[model samples]
Target chain A: MNVVLLDPSEVRADGGASLDGRRAEHVAKVLGKAPGDALAVGVRGGKLGSAQVVSSTKQALELEACVFEREPAPKRPITLVLALPRPPVFRRLLQHVTALGIERIVLLHTRRVEKSYWMSPSLEPAAIDTQLQLGLEQAVDTVAPDIERARGFKAFAEDRLPELAAGARVLVAHPGPFGPCPVDVPGPVVLLVGPEGGFIPYEIERLTEAGAQGVSLGPRILRVETATLALLGRLGG
Target chain B: MNVVLLDPSEVRADGGASLDGRRAEHVAKVLGKAPGDALAVGVRGGKLGSAQVVSSTKQALELEACVFEREPAPKRPITLVLALPRPPVFRRLLQHVTALGIERIVLLHTRRVEKSYWMSPSLEPAAIDTQLQLGLEQAVDTVAPDIERARGFKAFAEDRLPELAAGARVLVAHPGPFGPCPVDVPGPVVLLVGPEGGFIPYEIERLTEAGAQGVSLGPRILRVETATLALLGRLGG
Candidate 1:
């Protein structure tokens, strides 16, 4: 864990907390923290700061004090609209984007998205929370992104995407003879990345009608997971 | 497979080839290619072309005609120097960078890198080739990267790095009070990324002494794989 992140409820009224499991193991072994050493700490959806280790053990770490001095980690003004990938890939995608600081995520349905992907256990709330926590831990951030599922491509294109793209720079990452993905975008951006096979022509038209301009990542076709990170890095950087 | 890649020996004198394996499965089911269908094909480390499927079954595909007119996929002038990641992560990293068009890769040993990582079966030549081929298939590319193992950090930094960094924009990705990574670079670049925990101060100093200019990715700490992709997209874009 880059930084110890705790839920608000985990901390006592006096700003002390005790953590066990992976975080504790990280503190005890990976970080090799000793008693009285200050450990970087943050609360989920809250402030960032440091906490003093009151006690440290292989499986547990107790914090005697915490001081919230700085604001939470910054969130990128980017919302990722991804066609549900394979279950294994989806897990990694969640962690990757979450680490990259995407503020919102939309699990979208496109013509090429497999129907069975929606049934994967990776989408369960608790399972997703685990992945998001892993990302936050990796990035040393505490902000959890809001995630939504858009099950119907037509409904999402006609009813929701237009509203989402009204003021945002909506770019659909499609392979074609088109412009490059923009960098250092000024405002909010809603990026739609299709499934592995890519968006069919009809689906691309629907997305375009929703205000997303088709953009080529490059000549080489990229996996959705890698493509998402590349886009976020360029856009957010 | 976005593009089917075959070894030179696999193609017969008449330019016909039969494949029965994962590639065949992809061609049969995922692509749903029928008899006389033109499939995008490439010779590994050779030409990019198309092959006409003479017959297709769930487990095998036979090609009766082949045309290789186009050049191989382009390779970026970026050489990556990475502290070998965890075994599972390494498999993905190799494929990731290969797909991103890195021309050369050096898997280096750093102070923080675990000694046991060198013993991973994933490093076997056959295993490495499989990952590279998968990456080539993913990106529709035929070029493969040359990867080297640098067992000693000091020797690499002193004996080898000076020559590698010579006349190249060498940037070592390290967290520090350093400048942002450059974009739209004029020439070749050699990028060195550290282990998960990061390179120690002494290692960073040695790298700097060897002519690497330190650059920060951003505020957030990123996994080596994600950081590498982000850098490639920015530098190669």
Candidate 2:
């Protein structure tokens, strides 16, 4: 873990935090932290700071957090609307997008997406939280990303997408004669990426009519996770 | 598999090829190819073409390879010099870089790299080939990337790096006061990335002295794989 994160409930009124379970084990074993050593710490939805270890044992660990400047990580201006990837890929994309500082994610349904993917346990709130937490920890950020699911492609494109992308430029990543994915795009963007076989022609036309412009990522086909990262990076995330 | 790849040994003298095992299963079960159905195929280090399924059975499959085109995927002009990542990360990275069309990879030893990482079975030629094949299949590329290992950081930095990076812009990915990585650069580049904890100051100094200019990817810390993809994408890979 790049940073140790604690929830508000875990901290005492005196600014001291008692860490147990996974946190304690990580601090004791993986980090090899000792009393008096300062570790990078952050409160969920709060400030980032350092915590001095007060005492440590196999059972529990204690820390006295000294709040410092409240500087958050760079915010990603892009809102990702992605066709829900397969379960294995979904897990990595969650961690990757979070680490890259994507503020919001919309798990979209497209024609090529398998219906079974929506039933995977990886979409559970707790499982997603765990992956996002790892990403937040990696980026040393306190704010968690907002995630939502859209089960109907047409309804999402014709209804919800227009609202979500009202003030943002909407771009759909597709492989074709469309303009190349722009680099260092300024301001907010709502990026839509499709499933493995890509969006059906009807779905693409619907999204295009909904104000999403198609963009290509050159000739080689990249996996959904890689393509997402590549687009985010190109947009200066 | 997006593309079925056949090595020269698999192709008969008359340009007919027999497939079995994994390739056969992928063609039959996954892609559901039948007689007279044409699938995208490529010969290793050769032309991209279409292979018509001539026959299919549970035990084996047959195809008539029509070498139609010499078009390979767009080439990635960047050569990657990366510290050996952890086993799982290494496997994914190999696949990712190959999919992104990176043709050369040099696995370097650095201060933060664990000694055991060098001993991973994932580094074996056969294992590496498997991962690269998966990537080529995903991208529909026929050529496999060249991979090398450098055991001594100092020696490699002082000796081989200068020669390998000759005539190419040498950019090192470091999280510091360096300028943001360049976008859409025209020409070949040799990109260096560090291990998990990152390269020490001494290693950075050595690389800088050896003609590598450090570049940043903004504030948030990204995993090595993410950073690599981000930089490559920004560079118009």
Per-residue lDDT over B1-237 for candidate 2, one digit per residue giving the tens place of the 0 to 100 score: 788889968878877899898888888888888899998889888878887889876668898865648778767888899999999999999998899998699999999999999999999999999999999999889987889899999999999999988888999999999898899878889999999989999999999998999999888888998899989888885
Q: Candidate 2 — which residues are off by over 4 angstroms? A: none
True lDDT of residue B123, candidate 2: 91
TM-score of each: 0.96, 0.98
Score residue A40 of candidate 1 by CA lDDT.
95
DockQ (model 2, Cα): 0.80
What lDDT, from 0 to 1, does candidate 1 have? Answer: 0.88
User: Judged by DockQ, which candidate is best?
Assistant: 2
Q: Which pairs of residues have clashing backbones in candidate 1?
A: none
- What is candidate 2's CA lDDT for residue B65? 61
Candidate 1 recovers a fraction of native contacts equal to 0.64
Write down the worst ten-residue block by lDDT for model 1 chain A: A228-237
Residues B154-229 of candidate 1: C-alpha lDDT, one tens digit per residue: 9999998988888898999998899878775768899999999999999999999888999887788888877888
